[model samples]
Target: MQWEIVVGLETHTQLTTESKIFSGASTAFGAEPNAQACAVDLALPGVLPVMNKAAVQRAIQFGLAVGAKVAEHSVFARKNYFYPDLPKGYQISQFEIPVVQGGTVSFLLGDQMKTVRLVRAHLEEDAGKSLHEDFAGQSGIDLNRAGTPLLEIVTEPDMRSAEEAVAYAKTLHTLVTWLGICDGNMQEGSFRCDANVSVRPKGESKLGTRCEIKNLNSFKFLQAAILYEAQRQIEIIEDGGVIKQETRLYDPDRNETRSMRSKEDSEDYRYFPDPDLPPLMISPEWVEQVRSEMPELPGQKQARYTGDLGLSEYDAVTLTASRAMTDYFESALAVAGADKAKPLANWLLGEFSASLNRDDKTPAESPIAPELMAALVKRVVDGTLNNKTAKVVFAALWEGKYSDVDACVKGEGLEQISDSGAVEKMIDDVLAAHPGPVAEYKAGKEASFNFLVGQIMRAARGKANPAQVNEILKAKLS
Candidate 1:
């Protein structure tokens, strides 16, 4: 029997504000434990919580970016929970009234564009980290992250496959980062997701018992965890065993999920409006101001890249995936011109991405300047260096030492060998060595022609102009 997977995601994105949500403490990561924590963050008695204006502004910015309803009045509620990491014993979050509601994020699943509906995005305070190391028997609690501002974005169960869920998550991550509402740093726990997954018979209307996978920080893991869990649930139900609704943790090393605990329902939290803080009232003027300042989102940027820049749909989507990459691409294109767009796209997505992967750095941390990349593209276009030689120059540029493309080309002696005499001599040597192949080519064998081309390229050590070599070889053979 065919099974259908139903998936929903609750993503927690830390706001990019400089200060904590309810305290004057710094929200910086990697600080000394408890150094950034203030009295309010410690949840000390007599310390009242004050909302950060910047956090509210960022939430509004997100609402504007996604075309969601920005509520003029929103309230914070106390989510009662007990853990070593939660200092206040109850987290201040939104329950019934959230800041943003009813937005949709559209993304591509291959050639099809699918829209995932966002139920709501609410403001809340982050819990602290529990350290399991450096203690023989007891764990340590670091309150540094406590009371940090977070935007919990909950999406409707619109995805069917794990790939779809991951694609949707990545799209939302890019959107939040591009809108400057969040940093979207998955490694530092700045951005995280909890996926609720279930499996039912293909035509079954009622949902199956679902499991929630917690703290998935990467896209690959998110896909794998959901897939593993869905298969496991399907197997259990097929074997005549009922599926249990529980919380699971993804063990990436094992490529499986383990049950953590039974999933808690909403009523278990006993959510009540926080008495310490009043309802947040944002004026329409504030929302409009943020809306006017909202940058071009990924969807709009993708359309512009394809329509205005004349890039392929694939290239446009890839280039507009991140705001930093898009900015770098445009800056380089402006200097390189429209004629160099396809080549620039290839180099950025190919060589540039390879370097980024090798160095484990993001586009924001790219060492090569856009102007320098443009210069390299210009060198290739103007024939100062061939495509093969430009790769070497690109490596130098990526190391941040090469200031001039001309100087690098000259220093590396990578000038294209366009001399007809030199190319003809090399082609003559190849023809003399491979008479049978030359005869085969003369007899209309296409493979022999490619073989001869490879020999010519090897003879020139990738320095010869390929088109010119092909022309000269054909003329000499004729």
Candidate 2:
């Protein structure tokens, strides 16, 4: 029997607030072990937790972005648990009523659009880190992240393959970072995913026993972990063994998952509403205010690029893949004029993208400024330079050797020879000098025509406008 994989992702997104969710402690990353942890984060006696207004606002912003219903009233519950890093002995989180509910995350899987239904997104405090390294047979606990704000966005089991799961993760990452709510930095643990994967018989209505892969920070690891976990479950089922539901950890070195512990259910957490904190209330007016402040979402931008800008669907999608890239393209387009959208898009997606990748930089980090890029494209459009010569100027601009497009063209002597008279003179010289090839062309040898054009371009020292050269060469030969 064939098995089908099912996946659901629970993403913990660290809010971009300067302080922890329920405390005044700093939320900045990479501080000394416990320097950022305050009395509230340390759970010291006589300390009470206070909610961060910025964290709540960010959660509302995300809710509106995903078209989810932001709850007017929600409750905070204490998730009772005991771990070395959990200073409070229980985590403050949402239980039955979360802040956001019933949303969908849509992404492109190749050319096909796939959407994952979100169950809920709740505001929670992140646990601290347990350090095992640099200690000899002992562990250390750092509570700096104990009270950090996180939006736990949970999704339904809507994915059938590892590729679909990865696509969903990447789309979510782009959206969160675009919203400015989260940095979406997997390296710093700002955004982490826990994938619940299972394998069931094809066409079966019943779900199989699922295992949660904990804290996959990388998309490549998420995909690899899911694939490995699915195969592991399938092999067990095929061998007439039962699949146990547990939490597993992915070892990148081995490319496999090892069971950490049995998976726990809601009942296991012993959740109860906190007495110190009142019911969280959100007004309809507040939601509307947040909705009004939201930036144009990716979907909205994609539609506008295709409909108003007349860009191809693929081009629009590629341009809107990241906020930084979209900003770069739009800024260049504004300077280059609206009619230059196609060329601007091509440069951004083609040469600029390749250069960025080669240098291991993002569009935001590129040396080529938007105005400079616009100027370069404008020169090509106005026939001041052909594509080949324009690239020389582009290289000089990228290397910071030239700040102005015109200066670079003049300094390098790479300007296109667009003067009709000058180009005609050169072509006439080429035809006169190459009599044998010209005679062969007049005798119906079509290949000689290309040879004559090459000679004319060589005569122009490679700066002649190719289109003008071809047009004039064909006319003179006729």
Best prediction by lDDT:
2
Model 1 error, position 136 (Å): 3.5
Over 4 Å off in model 1, which ranges? 399-401, 419-435, 475-478
Candidate 2 global lDDT: 0.93
By summed lDDT, the worst window of 10 consecutive residues in model 1 runs over 396-405
Model 1 TM: 0.92
How much does each candidate deviate from the true structure in C-alpha RMSD?
A: 2.4, 2.4
Q: What are the per-residue Cα lDDT tens digits for candidate 2 across 402-447?
A: 9999999999999888889999989888888999998899999999
Model 1 agreement with the true structure over 1-478: per-residue lDDT tens digits: 9999999999999999999999899998999999999999888889999999999999998888777899999999999989988988999999999999888888888988899999999999999999989899889999999999999999988899999999899888988888887899999999999999999899998888889999999998999999999999988988999988899999999999999999999899999999999999999999988888878778887888788778888898888888889999989999999789988998999999899889998787888888888989888877767778889889877786678888888887888998888888999999999999999989999899989999999988888887788899888888
Q: Which residue pairs overlap in candidate 1's backbone?
A: none
TM, every model:
0.92, 0.93
What lDDT would each prediction earn against the true structure?
0.90, 0.93
Which candidate leads in TM-score? 2
Clash list (residue pairs), candidate 2: none
